[model samples]
Target: MQADITVDTKGMACPMPIVKAKKALDNLEPGQIMEVVSTDKGSVNDFQAWVKQTNHELVHYVEENGVFTFYVKKQ
Candidate 1:
């Protein structure tokens, strides 16, 4: 999916991905999408739970060569 903003959290660990995602999401308007590229393996589950709790939509995600790319749309 296309995103209005993209945040690269590659090489960062744990909370950092979520932290950057939160900040990026904060800057977006409702209905805007944010793309996050993270190298942390745990980010898959973390982003899923975070989006559920925050009421955002996890548009989709893909893993290639250990890099996980997530597309989230703000509600």
Candidate 2:
């Protein structure tokens, strides 16, 4: 099963996207997917490390044209 949420954080810098993503994840139920799109390059690595630390599942992530997209599942 798969569920998706999209977060757009353009023009935002470090910690903002990560902060918002964490907040959004709090509202999600287990197994739900959250998709975060950020213009911040730090988000790519930050999100990845966060998921690893938190034990959440990271489905996929990609960056294109300075846009970073992450697909993570709530634990």
RMSD of each: 0.7, 1.8
lDDT of 1 at 27: 90
Model 1 ranges with Cα > 4 A deviation: none
CA shift of 18, model 1, Å: 0.4
TM-score of each: 0.96, 0.90
Candidate 1 per-residue lDDT, tens place, 26-55, comes to 999999999999999977897899999999
lDDT of 2 by residue, 1-75 (tens): 244678788899988999998999999999899988899886677779899999999888878998888888888
Q: Runs in model 2 with CA error above 4 Å?
A: 1-3
lDDT of 1 at 64: 100
